[model samples]
Target: MNQNVATSAPFLVFTDLDGSLMEHDSYSMEAAKPALAELARRGVTPIFASSKTAVEIIAVQRASAITAPFICENGAAVYDSSGKILTAFGLPRASWLDAVHQLRERLSLRFTGFSDWPAERIAELTGLSEGDAGRARSREFTEPMIWQDTQANFQLFQSEIQKLSLTTLEGGRFISIQSQFDKGYAMKWWQARHNQPRPFLVALGDGPNDVSLLAAADAAVVIKSGKSDQLDPQGPATVIRTSIPGPAGWNDGIRQILNLLDSQQLLIY
Candidate 1:
């Protein structure tokens, strides 16, 4: 909670948005902006790794004033500081479509493809709320399709590679499949390329989509409120499991990590 310690710790902070940074339904990042910006001013780079599309992530980045590389669509792609595509991991488009079609044919569920369709068409077919659909279209970059509830919707979306996909059902909140992309793979890719002397990698997330990145990090913080724990079988790192929830919990979690770094003399706060 003390602002002094945060500015002294130099570390690569990768965070997930939906439940980690923003509230689940309200989607507010206002509370943490100052701390995040202060961290950046002090030589810490806050990298955003999330299931959101590149466009959506970029908007969040701009809002947060973060110019760091971003992992989008669950690590399907890692965009560099220049915003150029550095590395992309996913199946080919044709193969991805084939898999979707085949899965759609075999199962009993609704289907939608991220194909280059007009936003109107996407909304008509996938039945995404007009507001959410509009946001997807307004973005310069975004995941292609929006599918509804059902195993068919889940499988059809996950059957492909290359681009990341998000599946939202009627009674359920959205769930992002690792498939050909995600946070874990993105963070690992970044670590390999930069090869910086990492003080101690830490990842904080709130959902199954964050599991991969959490597993990859030296330390992980899982926000407990939603179904994230049920979605994650492995759970968070044993080192610091603060009982605080939401943004308060996240801030506390980071403080805990900084405490460890300070004790080790790796940081000064």
Candidate 2:
């Protein structure tokens, strides 16, 4: 968290899951709860923007006791506070499997397509380790696509999917294949549809997957992880870097934002 940010009611806070909010191993939220509640008390809302499925995002929202807006599937769907389906925008409905089948036939490449499949089925397709496959399938928190040797396949998939008017986002493990999607598009849609206040917006994320929404915010914070380099390669003013890692980084980071609020006499208790 950076001390230079502004904090005011009606502020919008967007955060990424996994490495940004929860520890890689423990998935803890002990420190985050109070900060969230405080934001709610101050009329600030927390929006979850992550490369997770709708089902996974719903469960996390419930677990965190947050009812704010959520961006799922790396900004494919946005859910409002009441849990109503605010909007769905992303990849065209053409069959991805059919596209892959066609591309592989024409370009001579290997590829696979997955929907909301069971853990075992996903593991079988991607040949992921048992533990990794189990986590992906369990859906206790996140639902991510599994890709088998993604790099080579993704390039081909991108060109092919584009033919069908769709795009793919690179998940750390699995590649999220969908119609052209970007977190910024989803965020802008939310802002436009809701006509929400233009309060100081803050976003925090880790991973190359989060680059777009990180750039969309009034102020952005990057968790000191491998993906930090992906943000503002050319440099940006509103971007801030965190020193801590994972959930600890979130705690320290948000605290820094809140402290800035305190300094400005904006936050109460």
TM-score, one value per model = 0.71, 0.77
Worst 10 residues of 2 by lDDT: 1-10
User: How well is each residue in 161-201 modelled by candidate 1, as lDDT tens digits?
Assistant: 22435232121143322244556877877776643454456
C-alpha displacement of 190 in model 1, angstroms?
0.3
Candidate 1 lDDT at 91 equals 41
lDDT of 1 at 134: 54
Candidate 2 on 1-269: residue-level lDDT in tens?
11111234455678887678866445566656666656666666667887766666667667666666788878877876666777777643344545555666786665444534666776675554444455445322122455555576667657766786766666545666666677767876766653335555677787777788777776677887765666672222456678877776776777777777668644322
- Top candidate, metric TM-score: 2
Alpha-carbon lDDT, every model = 0.59, 0.64
Candidate 2: which pairs clash?
A: 1-253, 91-179, 166-179, 167-179, 167-180
Model 1: weakest 10-residue lDDT segment is 168-177
